[model samples]
Target: MAPKAWTTKEVEAALRGQCEGRHRVAPGLYLRIEAPKPGEGGRASWSFRYQINGRSRIMGLGAVGDVTLAAARRKAEEALLLVRGGADPLTLREQRAREAAAAALAARMPSFREAAQQHIESQQAGWRNEKHAAQWAATLETYAYPHFGDVPVDRIDTDHVRAALNPIWTTKPETASRVRGRIEAVLDSAKVRGWRSGENPARWKGHLALLLPKKAKVQAVEHHAALDWRDLPAFWGALAARGGAAALALRFAILTAARSGEVLGATWAEIDTVQRLWTIPAARMKAGREHRVPLSDAALAVLAEARAAGDGEGDARVFAGRGSGGGLSSMAITMMLRKMKRPGTKKPWTDAAGETVTAHGFRSTFRDWAGEATHHPREVIEQALAHGLKDKAEAAYARGDLLTKRATLMAEWATYCTRPAGAVLPMHKAAAQ
Candidate 1:
């Protein structure tokens, strides 16, 4: 006898009423039911059978309640279509599973913070100093990391870059500019490593340039507060009387026209008493070129005083700090300038602008004196200052540093600064044409 065809009622009853094993719904669809056991209710599930490449395979559609008989039949039709299309249903399922797993793994990848650290470490050797590396990490930590550090590099976008830079763009333009560049560099490196793929969100030109105010327009050029060249003789008189490493260092800086860092980092090895020259290594110089500073009579005297004071042990800093074997703090000379009292008034000796003069500003004082009082050539003055040449062709052809002329100029400068306060000097009279 032919069995009655399966209906919806028959299928539900088979599953709910615990009628044992399996029933075929259609040619390729089936529902399997298990009898109730000791402490658990029975469960039912659906499977679809299809032939791919002449091999029959079974695929689970879903649980019976989750996927009804009608749904299973529809799925069976879909699977059969896939089989006719020459694709294995099980293999297709596995491929989809692998794709999903890959997506999850990628989503769990290391974020911008990790990538930035790795990038900094990789490029640390090429940077100028430990401070340079520290600054790169510090700026990112202060301004950028709080906002987007944990975001996966693959997902960083324009909005993230904007958020990090916008607040400080107007207030701290220089720092903000640097931070933006760093973010761009780290992202570019991440893309090259296959961890990220997209246009860099931190790009300034065209992308961010449109959004933010022009940096040059927003920030005014601020020159360092400088001491007037006129007040220098009086200031020098007061400075010469003060005795200590700081005072001597300040005097040396003025006489040599060297930067405070170069003065502070000076060692006995860098000095030559016989040659009357102070040879600052390229590493210590701002231009990254070795500089020879002519030690004027006064400058040699200051060095002689420093050596006699026992600044340190062998090959130690010529101006050692209170800390053993350490160079003087950058503030040491500035603090000395702050403490000097004006000759008549109890107030501190300040520049013409009434602001305290900076150690760095003394370079401006030297420049003013050279321009207004002396007949030395501009190149000689520039060379004495250890300034890099602005003209490329001029720099290329000008092999000589004018050291011979600089020695004479520096000695004259030392004489002028050491002269009694308010003394008059005959200004150079230009020869009439």
Candidate 2:
């Protein structure tokens, strides 16, 4: 005869009674009750006992409080069916549990934007400064985010990457290139965390390169617009006539032949009035190396003027913005140049090619003058501009910065900038002097 099944009332009695032993509820289901231990309450739960290959096995259904007698019977009946089918019910349950866990993990995978943000946070410590981090975030937000930022990183494909880059590829080739690289980096990071698989869709060399035109092919290399070296003297005269922090900053930048970022970010602490030097920290320089700039008399005068205006002191910005005590806006010098008239004419000062002169272009102007009109060595000129050597052999041996030689070059440049426009010097004559 088949074993008797449990009733609801009998199951409730088993939970409340003082009995402490296993009681059969069905052919394979049983209610287990344990005696109360030291401070713990008595325990009652359901277990399904079955036979497989003439061997007994047990599976936990649930607690009596959670699984009712009727539910326990149904679960046991299912396990018995599986046992008769030559399958181990416990093994199947464990497999189901593992599958559920994997599903849960897949659901928690990050979106493209989330992955990008995580990657940026993880890499911030190695970047040069906060501005680099900010730039990374800004580009992704403006370019990458709108296309597929909310999509799961694992689902991102080449189509999404192409969508983000195609619009800017030819028009803003440089920015598009950066955006593509950033997307590749974010996707690579996602893959590393096992959130995604497959090759990176944003990769350029063998992948996107096949789809899009090369950056150089689509866009001509554009050099910064620079004033002709011959026009610099008259331009300097006009600049000296103006009296403002922006004008002073521009004058100082031109004198030092420094990049606009370096000039605008300069603090009084970086300037040594006695040594006539401006030392830019490695963090601020583009090459990630410390650079020493030899300051000329003209550059020193600009600093003095800034000092008189209450901007020069320890750690204070040499060209401070109004009311913020921070460095002047990056566009301050450019805007100053924009408003200046060409000598006596109403037109703005522009390069010979008719492009508006940019603050960075002054470096090119300085380089041209040094190469064509002065006798300074190429290494000294490059050192003054804080440029990295391209020749590996020369760079390996060129350990010194050529500071003394750079000082002489800068002083000559300053004198040339301040001299009369008509006083043109022959190259040989200037070299002899």
Using lDDT as the measure, the top candidate is: 2
Task: Give the Å shift of residue 428 in candidate 1.
Answer: 5.1
lDDT of 2 by residue, 1-433 (tens): 8777778888888778857899998989999999999999988999999878888888999987788888999999999899888999998999999999767756798789888998999999999889999999999999999999999989999999999999999999989999999999999999999988889999998999999999998885768999999999999989999987788888989999999899888999999989888999999998989999998888898898888886568889998876667888878787888899987688988998888899989999999999999878888899999998999999999999988888888989999999988797665322332
In model 1, the worst 10-residue window by lDDT is: 424-433
**What TM-score does prediction 1 earn?**
0.70
lDDT score, residue 24, model 2? 96
lDDT of 1: 0.85
Q: What digit string (tens of lDDT, one per residue) describes model 1 on residues 282-361?
A: 87788899999888889988988988876544578999776456788888777777777888787876677788878888
lDDT measured at residue 152 in model 1 versus the true structure, 0 to 100:
87
Please give the CA lDDT of all the candidate structures. Answer: 0.85, 0.89
